[model samples]
Target: MVSSDHIGPNETGRIRATVKTDGKKGRILKTVQVETNDPVRPLVVLKLRANVIDAFHEKPLQPDAIFRSPCRKCHLDRGRDQMGAALFRADCIMCHMRGKSAPSISSLKKLSRERLKEAIEEGVPDSMMPGFSWRVGGPLTEAQIRSLLKYIKGR
Candidate 1:
């Protein structure tokens, strides 16, 4: 929430937010979008990061855990009906974007198409990357995977 809806020139205001960490662990990133009237930059994105430690502490969560319960509310349900770039932004970008645990788009673009496909379909072994294919206990369907592949490749 913002301290005020309006801020005069040369004035400052506070933007505060809260996050629920109940079933979440490890590094989590959340974004807040602020809309301004400035002609130069109308919208600003603020990133909030927190290392949520519950009983798990610093242990890595099972990749598939994101597909369950509370985590799925943000990670899975948001992208359920999305495809292509929209899907990436909703489901993948939070972790895969710059300065996160997952590989950024620049690095991912370097992989061969076949290798990238395999990575998305089968996921990296014993890593935080989970296979997105529904056949592998993930939420993505064959068509969604194909759409994501095309979107990533085109990036």
Candidate 2:
């Protein structure tokens, strides 16, 4: 459904779409044709891709649930006090707990700046810590990763 059929000059448009697979699996691709009255371009195509998995569904994670993991509860309040702190709290704090399977961020003090940067950018092998650098399909930028490193080292 489209919010408005007609779009005015310099105005934005909103569209709400729903696709039902109905128990089908595998990759599904669909293209939506948006008809417009502009002289230069009359139609726009929007491609949407969805992957349907048959098993092992995953739950979405919420940033506000900062204390979902037991270890996060320990530094619950203190963890929210830095630039990268929010980033870390949103992405890392869950798996990288102090006494859990993943080593705590506090232990990163032993690593050199270059090594730490590589670990975040390239990720650890055979480990749960995924790379956060966009170069490797991760979400974090160099500056944001550096900020996280600085936050980890208490600097």
Candidate 3:
């Protein structure tokens, strides 16, 4: 909708319009036409294009990157293992939700710490899980991996 169809040059020579979109994902194209008093150029047209998508509230990390470098800056606190908890929430919760593909905390508690660390660092072969170490093309550093482990083990 245009604020006004007619605009005077002395007042405020501006063209303003607004568009509203629904909860649908798609491409949109619109052309707006304006008429002028000039004889040489009597009309002007503007085109607008937009792409809409429905996505998660928080964007996931890149497939090849475990975590973003910027996010690591603020996650330096080691007290209470908050960094580990944050990492798990950001990375693991997707596939390891309760009663989902991954086992529960109670089930994982039976495994030895070394075994759990091995699985997390190396990932199981032919599985969807990916190793989160930079040496293996993952986003986590050694310390971050340890933090994640501590968080998972509730230590």
lDDT (10s digit) by residue, model 3, range 69-122 = 453322222222335777776566655668566766666667888988887777
Q: Locate the minimum summed-lDDT window of 10 residues in model 1.
A: 52-61
Tens-digit lDDT string for candidate 1 (1-155): 89998889899999998887755778999889989898999999999899986664256788878889867877888898789899988889878889888899888888888988888888899788888888898888888888888888898
Off by over 4 Å in 2: 1-83
Best by TM-score: 1
Residue 88 of model 2 has an lDDT of 79
Candidate 1, overall lDDT?
A: 0.84
Q: Which is the winner by lDDT between candidate 2 and candidate 3?
A: 2
Model 1 CA deviation exceeding 4 Å by range: 1-58
- Score each candidate by Cα lDDT: 0.84, 0.68, 0.62
Q: Which residues of candidate 3, in runs, are more than 4 Å off?
A: 1-82
Clashing pairs in 1: none
- Winner by lDDT: 1
lDDT of 3: 0.62
Worst 10 residues of 3 by lDDT: 71-80
